[model samples]
Target chain A: MWEYLNHKNGNVLAVKNLRGKNKEEFNYSQLNKKITKASKGFFNLGLRRGEVVALISENSPRWLIADQAIMRIGAINAVRGCNSPAIEIEYIIQHSKSVGLIIESRSVWEKLSIKNQIVENLKFLIVLEDESFGDFLGWNTFLEIGNKNTSEQYEELIDKCSADDVATILYTSGTTGKPKGVPLSHANLLHQITNLACIADPKPGTSVLSVLPIWHSYERSAEYFFFSCGCSQFYTIPKFLKDDIKQIRPTVMATVPRLWEAIYDGFFGALKKMPKFKRNLIRLLIRNSSTYKKNLRKIRNIDLYETSFISKLISLFLVIKSLPLHYLASLLLWPNILKQLCGKNLKFPINGGGALPEHVDLFFESLGVNVLVGYGLTETSPVLTCRRTWCNVRGSSGQPLPFTEVKIIDENNSILKYREIGRIFVRGPQVFEGYLDNTQASLEVLSIEGWFDTGDLGFLIPNGSLVITGRAKDTIVLSSGENIEPNPLEIEILSSNFISQVQLLGQDQKNLSALIVPNMELIENKFAEKNLLEMNQDFEIKKYFKSANKLFIKK
Target chain B: MKLKNTLSQQINYLLKNRSGSRLEEQIIDLIFVEPFSLENNLLTQTLKQKRKEIEKKYDCEIKEMYKKQIKGEIII
Candidate 1:
């Protein structure tokens, strides 16, 4: 880790605490200063080296400050999500047995106060944000304390630290079950960044727009990657994805599938609302495009186009229309219709934290956006497979990062053949050492050979690209032993223009019933075109039911 | 001038001076006359409208949407 930092010395590591339109850039020197001040403040509060200090916060400048400061003091920084439910938050706090808790806001401290009844390991509360914590002191005087620290004291702390010491205890969202505390050492964090750098290859001075609720592993991984690449980071106000994208025009962005879906929905929704001629033209062009691409692929495969004039004409037309269509698509849809996709300065957009819906993957590719899907678990220091510049297999989550070895293991622990579905197991230097102090839980997932069971069912395609099938836990099983994977079905539902979200219920039931949230505008237009009433009142539900009935009957 | 007793009566009272046969047009007129009075306390109180309670109890009113079947529009 020291060697890595030494290599990246004097380079801009990260930008911190940015908001609104006025973008702020923080370099390594600036970050170093903040770390020194924070460490001095921690020392003043009687925090020693190797002590565990839990830093609970949403993404803020202070969170970064405390993160680097803990490293300076050789103390492990336990970063708990600010909005985690009391039980989950308490689990992390108690497991780490932190000497002090550095909270970002009063709201987080209040939530912790209730959980204190069950877990009493946290001794001191240091409020990073200017908020009143009940029975705890506020840190409104950070300026005075930070300013009092000398430069010599700051340098001394940095000189005394080692790379083998624990850096942070990040709690996974645990979509499967109980959230586990992943203790990442400085070496672990550095290795993950290095592995990410090998694939992402983000350039220095690249502006990154981050709004992934920074408490999550995806955002943290992205931040580390950005820092490693010497990029400037700019964050936005929560729920301001569209405006922020346009404002920052970030060279890179990291977001989830839902964000991509929202962007698609926003664009497509506006397209649906356009006058009949325009909509029909777009549909016709898009349909023709698929046929055109298929013929082009066939021509390329057979070499029939090598000498024929007709084939040369066909190739000329493809070249003429393809880039023009992309440009026109951006022009027509991106301005008002696709505002969220207008992070025009973006060179590489990393989609992770959840399954990147295949429809979304196709949509952006069609529009000429370089949307790359990556896969990982929090226990694997997050990024396992990622896309690269030279090559990409459209649907697969790219190749494994450098030396990360990925395999599919069957129920009996036998390795599966290519494209045969099974559990994904990853072994790498980037994998977390163990679940913080939970040996039983650690051993359940992590093998002695360093292979960690990702619990995600996926298969490797012939090209060595990984395609995630579904979560082993999220699979629904019926009483008669019919097992249904919901992820593919959810993806299908999400792709439908009328549908936003769908959850299938069929366990122990005769048939599946889906709970769906329909896009009101699409449904309303369909009703209007049918000379029927809108889907506003309860009585209007019958019209939709009839529509569905007709649709399925035709099928 | 007396308060309308029936929903149709009140709806007509609201729509009497409005143009167009559609409910959307009538609602537009009603809204323009009131100018989102429910958004303001003094205006709603002055109009003697218990907007929150009315909206809470009535789904259509809350959503400001009503679907009435219209024939002869579908080309098929």
Candidate 2:
């Protein structure tokens, strides 16, 4: 990491952090110097190699610097989400045996301090962007201490570090039980960076907008890979996501499914507010573009849509007959419109963190935005497979990355053939070493041969693309012995504009049921427009669901 | 809009169009609440629903609603 930073020329900007309406930029050399000084400071504080240092902070340029600093000194950096509860943070510190902590603010420190004491291994605390409160050391003061140590000392420490050494321990969000520490070695992370370099092929000076939580493995590894490629990254909050996208016009961005859904919702929401004529025109344009792409897919032999034989025959006839209209709509009208909406230079946006609804995938692609949906867990350096720019297939998680081996296995531990849905197990150099000091938990998922059971159910297509079905634990089993994967069903249900969130439930029951959260604003407006606002809410909801049921049955 | 009424109406609407006997028997009852969140402990940080916890919390209400439905009473 340091070598790449040092070799970069022309004072290239590495990271930019949005501050109010302004932005702060850090060049490659400046950030490299900061990492070195921070590393020296850690050494000056008598912090030794293999010691765990806790980093509790929001996503920022300094967060990456501190993470790299820890790696430089061969110490393990235990990163926890800033929004995590105080108890969970304390548990991670104690569990990982973290001797030092690098926090973002004094308020976060006070929150963690409220709990009863148990972190005996905690020797020092360094607060960034805040004044020293109590025994906490401020960021500048800590850096000043490192100024006393020579540059030679920092170089010596870096030389002693090895690729196999534990670099960071990222704690999972603990959906089921206690959050377990996933310790990723330097080699594990390096493999991802090298593999990502070839896969993403991000050119130097390419702009990447970082929005996901940096503490998470998915974002962390991607950030490292982007930085190694010499791409400049801009950090923005959710409130400014729209503004940032327009102004920065990033070439690449990473996001989650919820954000994609929100963007889709927001776009249509604005469209609904437009004048009747303009709205109808936009809708017509979208329909034309969607049809053009669908026809193009059929011509290209990538047709995944379901249609009757007669319908397909008619569509083919219509497509061949109206080639000029398709060309004009797809080439002339849609590209410029979508380019204006998502940024002029936007290549492809990567979606991870959760399953993206297939409708959302089609909606964006129809507008000429390439959406790359990926799949991985925190235990597997976060990304095992992702859709490439060239070979993107909608409704699939794309192909396994280079050097990563993915297989589907049944309950009896038998490997399944292609297109067979089973538990996904992965074996790769990018896989984490083990959970921090939790041998039993590690042994449960990881085999002696290094295959880690992802607990996610998926199948590999004959073309090597992966399609995730649902989680093994989240599957619903009916009393009639029928097992149902709810994710696909829920995703389909969520495609209804009236529905915002849903969870399917019916384990050991006769039939599957769902708990749904309706989009109240849209539903109320729809009811009002029909002069049915005075009716009971129950009746209105019934009508809305009936409409959605028709849609489901039709699909 | 009242959550319970909306939920009950939506549940009935969803079940009404189905033609199977199991479709009627499958969804026993519907209980509505505000959206789930991490603060409410109904959702995890990763945004997954905690099904076991939700079931445990609403066990009594679900059973009582089913009983009311059996008694031909409008529960919502």
Candidate 2 Cα errors over 4 Å, as ranges? A20-23, A113-120, A150-155, A175-177, A303-323, A330-332, A475-555, B1-76
Clashes in model 2: which pairs?
A511-B26
How much lDDT does each candidate structure score?
A: 0.61, 0.74
Best by TM-score: 2
Per prediction, the TM-score for chain B is 0.25, 0.56
Top of the candidates by DockQ: 2
lDDT of 2 by residue, A1-555 (tens): 665666864387899998422245788888888887887888888777899998999887777777888888899999975666676777787888888988888777777753336435567888877878777898789889878856565577777889999989988755222578999998989888888764577788899988878887888888988888889999998778888888889888888776776677677777878899989987876766667666665554444434566766777876675566656766777676655566767785888877676667778877778888787878889889998777776778888888999989998989998778899999998898788788998998899898998887888777688888766677564433233455545555565566677766765344456666777766665565554433366566657556646755665
Q: Residue A152 of model 2: what lDDT?
A: 62
Which residue pairs does candidate 1 place in steric collision? none
lDDT of model 2 at position A265? 64
